[model samples]
Target: MNTTKAQILDGKALAKKIQSDLQQKIATLEPNIGRPPGLAVLMVGDNPASAVYVRNKEKACSRVGIASVGKHFSAQVTQEELTAEIHRLNENDRVDGILVQLPLPDGLDSVALLHEIDPQKDADGLHPVNLGHLVRSETGLRSCTPAGVMKLLAEYNIALSGKKAVVVGRSILVGKPITLMLLEANATVTIAHSRTQDLTAVCRQADILVAAVGKPEMITPDMVKPGAVVIDVGINRVTDSDGKSRLVGDVAYDAVAEVASYITPVPGGIGPMTVAMLLSNTVLSYQEKMTI
Candidate 1:
């Protein structure tokens, strides 16, 4: 029995290293900029997951010497109020980056709120301007999760040129941006979504397969190509038969690990990298602001 496990991409470790690097850069820049780079994460409502995510992001910001200007609004906050707050952050010179936490209160329009943030301060990189820049292959703030995936691949020297890459999702947050990044790296890109027919056949042809669909363990071992590089961008909380809940990615880790040459584990994978890229984007904005 061949008991070889795939090499872990180790995103947590890389995220730490990236943070350390950013810390040093901030240290040097603070002397010139006169203030630390600032990031504002606005959260609406009291969703437990959003609370935890916001806390984590603020903690990461503090660790890397970036000042956190985060705020939590009431669930009853109006769309006009949120948009007004975003406009305020966009105008705040100290705030190098601005992000609105996802899944705002039911009546709130998340897209309109995101649109109000200045593209330069749009740290989440979901602004239409940034997305347009990505499509045109021009330099701009790229979405965090997909950018983190590309960074991990580059760190490990995984060759994307002329390779068959498949991304199994269609979310603006991950799927679309990642496909663009892969194409920029010279990969033949194909995106399969919920409506994709013969999803298994489509996935099996990938040399580089990325699962960003929110489904838990949707990509089984059979969907993976042998010796392929698998990147799991899904984060789903699942409870086992015993009733203990834990996070798991879209891919069935144990089964797929046996066949994949490389893979990213959930919890430690992509998650930390996403936070790291947010910090990077904030610093980039700070650097540009200082230069101007």
Candidate 2:
């Protein structure tokens, strides 16, 4: 029943370009800095998907000339032990960034652990200091995923100024920060969540719609306004008719693509951009150390 076609946002291409630029920049700056930028990604337990993400981040760091000083711990690793490691990384001069992988095994106080990480080296940008800086529009490491969304939008020359932007979801990771970022770009932002009534009606009011609710195929064609730009930040794995697992974004891609003017594909879109931004933040922290 779909007929019209929309242009792909192509975040994958932009991410590749960003990594290449970072690689070159690192090559040039290493001599003066005396060491490559280092990012420590601490992962606990063996969540298969989390492992994959950590591995991809390490690979990206290596390609960009950032040192991966990451670590892994068993699911039963105690909070005290993790805190000690975070403290050590925070003080190490070589470590420019420190990130605690999320959804830590049960009984771990992730928020408390996040609080322990030095604000300067908070690579994931989830630290209160960094988040506060974001709220105040100061220069600091930003949440990678949200920053990536903005970067991709800019890369495609999409105008956000005065645009009606609706973001579905209220999570701190993507929704809130992204709303602030869009507001900074002069876009009018409305954050809709589960409590929002008539979600489709609210979504249809946007010139720019961002779906970060983590629900697969939640945003169908009818929810999208024709000619709107849709950014899908949700990645969900679901089995298909063939019983094969595949990744899908919050928006129903095929159906929505027929309505929106532009859209981002899940596997190739936000995933890579988030990693790229993380590396970028690590390098930023690295540069700051050199000037100190």
RMSD after CA superposition, every candidate: 1.0, 1.2
Q: What TM-score, computed on C-alpha atoms, does each candidate reach?
A: 0.98, 0.98
Worst 10 residues of 2 by lDDT: 1-10
The best candidate in terms of lDDT: 1
Model 2 lDDT tens row, 1-292: 2356988999889999999999998998899988899999999999999999999999998888889998999999999999999999988999999999988988999999999999999999999999999999999999999999999999999999999999999999999999999999999999999999999999999999999999999999999989999999999999999999999999999889999999999999999999999998988888886678
Residue range with the least summed lDDT across 10 consecutive positions in model 1: 1-10
Candidate 1 C-alpha lDDT tens digits along 1-292? 1268899999999999999999999999999989999999999999999999999999999999999998899999999888888888888889999999998878888998888999999899999999999999999999999999999999999999999999999899999999999999999999999999999999999999999999999999989989999999999999989999999999999999999999999989999999999999999999996669
**Where does candidate 1 clash, by residue pair?**
none
